[model samples]
Target: MERAYKYELLDKYIDQELSDKERQELDALMTEDEEFKEEVEVAVMMNASFNVEQKQRWAKLLEAEATKTSVQPSQPTKTSETDTDQKETKVRQLQPRTRWLRIAAMLLPAVFALFLYLFLANSSQTAPQMADHYLSNRHQAPTITMSQGNDLSQNWKTAIKAYQEEKYESAANLLEPLTNSTNATAEQHFYLGLTYLYKEKAEPVKAIQQFEKSQQLNPAQYSAEGNWYIALAHLKNDDWTKAKPLLEQIVANKDWKWQTAKEILEEQE
Candidate 1:
């Protein structure tokens, strides 16, 4: 039952249906259970190995079956006192399992795919699509609050709030003033870069400049994340050549997103 529950969690996760609490529980499992992590990685790659057309076909079938089972009442299975009827029942039981075996036959040799199959299927798809998916799912901006009393400016607080609220233009305007302040730090420029990258009709060029400036000001603190955003910025501009090397660097240096970068680079190739 415990094992079945774990597989249920994986299915919900791959389906993007995991609640926040369940996601945290799964994260703990991944960190503590190597076997489960490996299973998840392979399952993701198998799902991603489907071609675009095949993915859509399978997705529709899966969704339909799931809905049917969930919303419709289950019909009772009647056992007959006949050999022919028993044979039919046995075949019915094996049919779904056989179908799954056929699906697994398409597995790629790789263990993991970047987007849990959301962005793979056709790895050559547009870079901006990939970048947008990654930014939406993978990026997390640190929360800044004045309660800790770390000398944070009001401007920084408001700008981050705007950023969190997805009001990128307001965030950019608020962050601009912070960047001009006497005590401006790398973090301020870093967030401003993020705003420029995400604001309506995004300015990737300006975003790249701000990320670079932030890295130059404090390489030790900002270099890892700075390079990550720069890579995505290049991707947003459809410059795979630029993004490729930065992702490679991330993998080489074992940054926090190294595994994600490695998988993204692998998918493109």
Candidate 2:
């Protein structure tokens, strides 16, 4: 748990058991310490090689073992001697090929754990520089207004006008009450979400909740469009996990601007 490497942490790392905080700390160490960085790089390479070879070897050994077991003579004969020899032969493959390699083997798990743990953590981090690059540009406030309905709907008209004018806080306040009303529409929830998602003083978590509610309120009309807003909200928050599924969903459905969603997903890698 300390900044220095511990065999226990290494064991967990190799076993894919490190906590998120521990993994991030290891990533920071790699950036700050050259010696540690080199050790991790070497360990990662060696462990990857070992795992591949070990899997292949185990596969072949199991196949041969199964064949031998199946083709046994009808006579009830036990070959403890043959079994022992076979085990010894197979185990010999796991032994280090050289003295230096043997010494490194003891420490490799720690370094490799650090390397692998950080790699996994990297998979879910934010890419702020790319978040708004294209998706944000493509967005525009709705041209049509829903002002023809009752008094609750009339507030949405005011909210939309406030939003288009970039009066985000006022727009958000105006729309918030509308969502709690029995007369609330999916379109109303969606507009409130946009107000919260304004780049200036953005509240991305609130934005996501609103967008998801919009979807639940009217799936037929808002499934694709609501998912799109939620994805944008996640991007604004620099949350890869929340954004990626929506991006993939959009791409799979060939939704509006699906090509751009694919590009964003690729860049995340």
| RMSD (Å) per prediction | 12.9, 18.7
Name the runs in model 2 displaced over 4 angstroms.
Answer: 1-126, 143-153
Cα displacement (Å) at residue 174, model 1:
0.7
Residues 50-165 of candidate 2 have per-residue lDDT tens digits of: 99678656655544443343442333234797976766655564443333454554545475443333222233445554554433443466656357445445677788788888
**Candidate 2 clash pair list:** none
- Of the candidates shown, which would achieve the greatest lDDT relative to the real structure? 1
TM-score of each: 0.56, 0.49
For candidate 2, the C-alpha RMSD (Å) to the true structure equals: 18.7
Model 1 spans with C-alpha error above 4 angstroms: 1-121, 145-150
In model 2, how large is the Cα lDDT of residue 36? 73
Number of the top TM-score candidate: 1
* Cα lDDT for residue 188, candidate 2: 81
Residue 101, model 1, lDDT? 42
- Cα lDDT for residue 129, model 1? 75
